[model samples]
Target: MGYVSQAESSFPAQVGKDFEEFIALSSVHCDGWGISTNDRQHAHAVLEKKVEAAAESATFQKVIADNAADGALLHLRWATKGLSISENNTHPFVYGDYSFIHNGSIFPPDSFSDFIDEKFKKLIVGDTDSERYFYLMMTQIEKLGLAEGIKTTLAIIKEHGKTTSLNFMLMNKESFVVGSEHNSEKKPDWAPADYYVIKYKKDADGVLFASSGWNQPGWHTLENHHAAIVNRSTFEIDVINL
Candidate 1:
């Protein structure tokens, strides 16, 4: 999941301005694209050849800047366990006003299927386990507060980790949560890969968090199993343990 909040006079009015270029570089993620804003204008686009082409075009950046949002989440999915790559099988799945995106799979979605409520089950419009996982987390958050919901969700994944990997990235208008193991089983070459989180207080009213150093100084690494919560306005960061 990706999160972006703009200052009143931010340099790039739209986060997608940069993100569309990023997505263009990520041809591997070809399923679909999902976007959300703090104002509740959610967009889920079916990523076809044309979309990819447009993402590569010069106008893509300007168009996204025109659609700038205060806070946004963008997703580019590489279909794994899902069916045909349609708009419905995209990332950044939304429920109510909440939006989520995932990076890893939760195998045997049916195994945890019963753990979710019927109402959430009805929201499953696609065949991806990632979407189900998103709904399950939403359901948990609805029943429990953010912290409790994370703990409960992690517990379920740890219990099932023996059979499947559950690496995920989730976010809403206020914050983002990333879950994953240290290594990638699919690409043995990435076994020693390390994940880091950086927190920054750009100004008295702005904070930023990112997985990697965005070529900016003061980017810090997030500890494993820790959650990074940023005050959307102040950019103050609070790292919480799950």
Candidate 2:
């Protein structure tokens, strides 16, 4: 889940309330959970992670209940095959000013190595493909800026990977960016048609985005292969095609 409220720093109480309900879905995504909150640009995010089911962690509930942020991203991991359920492999992977979480699989776990910058690759501590995917974007961002970097990375993965879903949220202190892409035909056999769907709701408070699993009747469905970025200070959204 990703949230960007009106510019300034104020924690909307509804996020915590809604997330409490979201945690129940951990029955399916039961490996681990992580969260990152940013109040504004240049400040360190309030990042927390646990290698346990979200519903079982008191710290998870307390962290959500206490921390305040203008922008925040949350993840409940259903560990990809061959990955370990450890803190090192948890979501909301942080690198400098950016926090990232991805929901998908990229074939050939090392497929992104050739694309990552040497320095970024050195920073990787986890063995999950998601962490490598993050570095791939960071490497591209160094040359193409945020949107283009994300676009290029997804394009490359689409061309080379047998992707299940590349849906993800990448946020820094100044912007929250979401990438939505997936092979509808490759949806999990036990999941619903909308299991890979991503949706959002914008109101007087701000915009809230999440993967489709629970009830989100009025939320707008973010189209597949599209990326949306929310400016942390202005709350302006830039919708781009990937």
Candidate 3:
């Protein structure tokens, strides 16, 4: 599982300043770190690298803090099978104006590629199931809108593959979506408490969504198969069951 933070209007400065604190909290799921901060228009810049090296960079921390973005997404990865540890395999995969990060593993990962549309197959730069899932998401978004696309994508994955978790954060410049999904009836040994839970809450700044490790004061766990839809401009959050 990975950790993600999506912010609107305010940057979670603590995420950058207290990098070690986050590392300690999310150490259970660790591999790479990736972030994409969006500008007023929703355009974003991405930076991702293996954690050991990224955590040591003063530049990385500075970029995280200095970005006065309206919306931002950050991910700390835990490698699944078959993928090598490299920047390409990092989270927060971006295409066009959309950015995505996930915290679940699609079992029998090889089957993921078969679901991708031919147009998106070429966009895949990494071997992680998360990236393939991202492409499938893009295809869904084209057919259904964002929120429904996310729901449909998860449903299709659950129908075709066995996934330990299907949690993800998908965002562009204007809006963002999140989900907390898992095979709760037959939870896998590797699926820790944190993997099945997603927490979020509204603060003075805006809404913050994260995995179990973040020390959020009023955060509430998103129910299984449930999702949170956030409007970046107004900061209104609506919770829906998928």
Cα error, candidate 2, residue 91 (Å)? 0.3
Give the winner by lDDT: 2
lDDT of 1 at 39: 37
If scored against the real structure, what TM-score would every candidate get?
0.73, 0.94, 0.84
**What lDDT is reached at residue 102 by model 1?**
64
| Candidate maximizing TM-score | 2
| Tens digit per residue, CA lDDT, model 3, 73-186 | 777776886778888888888887778888778876646567678899988887788888999999888889887888888878887888888888877766778888876655
- Pairs that collide, model 3: none
Candidate 1: deviation at residue 220, Å?
2.2
Q: Over the stretch 104-210, how does candidate 1's per-residue lDDT look in tens digits?
A: 55556555666677899998997877777777787788899776886787677556643334545555555555553333344324333432332333344344333
Off by over 4 Å in 3: 1-11, 14-20, 42-45, 48-59, 184-194
lDDT of each: 0.54, 0.83, 0.70
Model 2, span 1-242: residue lDDT tens? 88887654323364544555677889888899998887675557678999888889888888777767778888999988888889988999888778999998888777768888999989989898899899999999998998889988888777776789899999887888888888878888988888888998777778788998876767798899898898776778889998
Task: Please list the residue runs of candidate 2 whose C-alpha ends up more than 4 Å from where it truly belongs after superposition.
Answer: 7-12, 16-18
The TM-score measured for candidate 3 stands at 0.84
True-structure lDDT of candidate 2? 0.83
lDDT of 1: 0.54
Q: Number of clashes in model 3?
A: 0
How much does each candidate deviate from the true structure in C-alpha RMSD? 4.7, 1.8, 3.4
